[model samples]
Target: MLDVEVSSLGPGVIERALGCLRNGHHAETDVPYATLSSLLERAVEAQASDVHLVPGYPATFRIHGELAPVDGEALAPGDVRRMVEAILPERVRGRLETERNFDCSVAVSSGGQSHRFRANVYLAQGNWCACLRHVPTEIPTLEWLGFPDALAARLASHSNGLVIVTGVTGSGKTSTLAALVSLLRRDASLRILTIEEPIEYLHPVQGGSMVTQREVGRDVDSFADGLKYGLRQDPDVILVGEIRDRETAQMALSAAETGHLILTTLHTRDAKGALTRLVDLFPQDQQDDVRSQLALSLRSIVCQHLLPSAQPGQRRALALEVLHNNLAVQVAIRTGKIETIESAIQTGKREGMFLLDEDLQRLVSAGQVTLETARRYASDPAAIKATKPAW
Candidate 1:
């Protein structure tokens, strides 16, 4: 049976109280806040990517793609609700009540250092639940994120056109986008602007470029609004956190067409699917225009997948499809010959473009990853074997 705690004080206070108790210290008041803080500290210590607070279950932490329940009594629905509500601001609480779901940013301090979190609080099974994703304090570099040197170099030097990083949730899309933005920042003379929903990574203007990051709800109403204003900001580089709607997509294409380098992400399975999704986002009447714009402004598409490494207790490896815009590829896009893009990628190795299968095969041949794992994620298994080493 789950433990039930009746507390009107709220989850934040409860968390702090728990933290104090867990740390062998006592709090005079606000026991809930201490408890919540302690839970977060434990999650950080365990290197968890996300912490889940759900009704009828023990608090859970996701570490390396697996969820483990914290060793404690399960929480009742009321306790979960109170804890979640306590952390949210009044405005966010009002929005959650109206919308039944809310996305907000949370900052917590520990050991005199602050950590940021992207939180999604929603109603599940008629009970309030929350999931918190940890946001790193500093932007990660390409090498730090384990991207290939050649691929990172290409993304850094592309002066104009659109470059997209596509992946599903938790696939490190944001990390890759941050790496590219960081690379551009090193160029000193560039002006960069980014629009994100609940802004995850915060980049400091270290070298040449001046960067401005805007959050969707805080700085702007929507992704389209940011893109609309981004054009007038005189930015050399524009980073759209996600191409969510048709208006934003059109805006991104226009930015690319106007000679500004645009970087963004999408949720897609593969490189071919990424292009198809972009073109399909518009109405049939506008698709032709979208295709033309895309063909002209498309620079590169990098589709990444994170796979658990063969070695235990190690980080995941990224398999990527690096697509560069060339004449044949552009023609394929303009003519709606999306199927031909894969063959073009296969033959365009000399031109710095690589299909996902090619990258998987290289990893398998080098013994960095297994052929079985490569086949599981490959778009075409037959193509993967062609790159295998001879026994």
Candidate 2:
């Protein structure tokens, strides 16, 4: 029932696919690449964040962070494998076979607009499966996204030092950084260089700033290599996709010390967690040096986490904990008082540092988020309840 011919597949195919899954029968041949492409088209049309392909299941899309089945038939393991192969270029197929997993970016066109996707192709239960995150075609400015304006201006005003926008996966860290870069382009006249793996949001160099984007494994070998050579590229601002390893972190600090503003991301829970993760990346013997270097060269760390907004349409809003490296903050870092960092942030609001709970409370009070949702994600729900958002 799920084996409807690609040419003949049409209305009501989703029901057919679900029935096929119940009966445990699927066409074992290669589904047309256009089949998956059509699913992607539908996903983008629906503003889905990700598309997932798994064996013995229908294609699914992550709409507003929730998974929903795409309008299609259930795919057999072989069918999924073929779908993966169909999307991947032949040159990368060998790497997939040898490595069992690969990361790549692809561009899909639908409705006369091009949408980008970062693809993760991996083996699941010995069957090829893939997860694709839909990257927006246009790079958004902070103002356009309605991110905190003061914070965006502060991040863009930095001429030197390292600024990190940190969060867990699907937390919109990349989009945040991209917006910062766009703001910098509008507010300052500087050359901005970015190094990303397979470059996600293609920012067209515009306004007063010049943007030169390099792709890891394509334009350069790795983040370290691009960052090291970026120092000599006469750039005033550098954006490294993520501080993924010790080597990349070292180079990022080096660039920051050498008078280049380094913007990057780290997969951490909050600003304090980011500092701990950065220092812990180095060996114990080198941690003190890292902390010292970080104390001076760290400009700001904005930790972002998303929560379900009040919009019944499954939308999400950002809650941020912003940390600026002022003198008091620097002293805390230099003294290795990671425990006291949170306290410093609580009192440093005039300098643009605040806790996540503060932002969450603000959202709730503004009617952008519900009180229950805020409590679920807030750092101090009791405190928020006692004293309402002052914003």
Lowest summed lDDT across 10 adjacent residues in model 1 is found at 1-10
lDDT of 2 by residue, 1-391 (tens): 0112233346664454445434544333234445565677778879898999898778898887678886556677666655555556555667766887777887655555666788888888898888989989788777655577788888878999999999889899899888888878887789999999768888885787899999887689899999989888999999999988899999999889989999999999889999999998899999888999999999999888888768877568888999999888898888899989999998898998889888888888778788888888776677665345456
RMSD (Cα, Å) of model 2: 4.4
TM-score: model 2 vs. ground truth: 0.90
Please, what are the lDDT tens digits per residue for candidate 1 over residues 1-391?
0112222334355444444444544222345444555676667778888899987788899886678898776676656555555555555656756776778877666766667778888888888788989888888889888787887888898899999999889889988888888887886588889898878888874776799999888789999999998889899998899998888998899989999999999999877889999999998998888889999999899898887666665667788887889998899999899999898887788878887777788877776666777888888887666356442
Q: lDDT values of the candidates?
A: 0.79, 0.80
Per-candidate TM equals 0.89, 0.90
User: What TM-score would you give candidate 1 relative to the actual structure?
Assistant: 0.89
State the weakest 10-residue window (summed lDDT) of model 2.
1-10
